[model samples]
Target: EGLEELSKHCFDYAVIDEVHHAQAPSYRKVLARLNASFVLGLTATPERTDGVDAVALFDDILAWQATIGDGINEGSLVPFHYVGLKDDVDFQQIPWRNGHFDIAVLEQRVENSARMAKLWMAWRMHFGSRTIVFCCSQRHALFTRNWLRDRGVKAAAVFAGTGSDPRGESLRALVSGKLDAICAVDLFNEGVDLPDVDRVVMLRPTESKIVFLQQLGRGLRAAENKSRLIIIDFIGTPAIRTSDHSSPLIARRRMQ
Candidate 1:
């Protein structure tokens, strides 16, 4: 409805975020109706789930481009030590729908005592001073926080519904060394910066390469006394279930 109304007025340029979604039916329909003279699409990753190149929708013209590796080599982003610990949860057990797993069932499985124990073991094995744990749900994040706290690890969980950093405390606690980790569900994915986050724990399975990369950016920001970020990823057996992409371990194994 908003797009339809906006389509009536022509603009010189239309800037779109996460521009990779332009190929989707809704975006396509909206773009078709718009009468902009020029369009600017911005995205960190332009790959799509349907196997189509998103650049094609933007006229295939040359523009500014900066790859993650480029940023790492230039020293603007911290180089990372990625550790892929084997997770016991079978990927096939979760219901797959529309290119992603069912979140409800996946959360239940990931929140299991044994599963959480494995996750904690990996964190303990490679302990980073400050870490951000990406979880499947708010409950999963809270459970992880309490589980870690019980083991004497200072941790907290923050999400959208509760708003503004879960516990009504500043996330700056991570920088002060008061908090060891922050378990979150989409709160720190984007638009928020945590420069002191030296580690990232990917506990959720994601099909979108863009989202995976965005979550990773949470820990890549350069900071004092921080030379590298530690990425502890839980890799399940048989398959990792991401859309048309190899397991993150396979791609990041050379970093170690």
Candidate 2:
């Protein structure tokens, strides 16, 4: 209804934020109907996992590109200290197809008690005022949150279907220091500003570079007294394959 109302009139300018998602069917439909004199698309991530070129939608015009290193150098984002810990999970045993692992199998492989204990130990060793744990699924997130809470840590889980009220409250609590950590799925991956997060814990293996960067960017936002972001990444042997070297994190690991 909103789109229909807006479509009745032509606009002089149209701006689409998070334009990386413009390749989706809904976004494409809106773009096809938008009668704008000029359009501008903005996004931190231009790469798409579906092999579609988002930039080509803008008539192949190149505008600007900036990397994480650029943001850190310019003081817009804090530098990061990354620690890659070995994960005993055998990812090769999980089914991989179409550039992604079978999520159900992946979740089963990661959501075990021993793995959770290892994650808790890592977080305890490098504790921070605020932290976000990226999980493979809602079940994984809930399990992690429960595990943290049982240990007397103020934690909450947020994912899709966790309604706006509770999600908002949880985010507010984290920002206000009432909550120490949030175990989340892809809910915090993009379009969320969490400047106060000083630490990021990755419990799931990231297959896409875009996702890896987005997750890393969650804690990179500059905040008062935040000198640097600490990343505790659990990695399976297959995660560091040669194809993964294109990621900045992997590049940094190679240098180290």
How many residue pairs clash per model?
A: 0, 0
The CA lDDT of each predicted structure is 0.77, 0.82
Any idea what lDDT model 1 has? 0.77
lDDT, model 1, position 61: 74
lDDT of 2: 0.82
Tell me the spans in candidate 2 whose CA falls farther than 4 Å from its real position. 97-99, 162-165, 240-256
Clash count in backbone of candidate 2: 0
Best by TM-score: 2
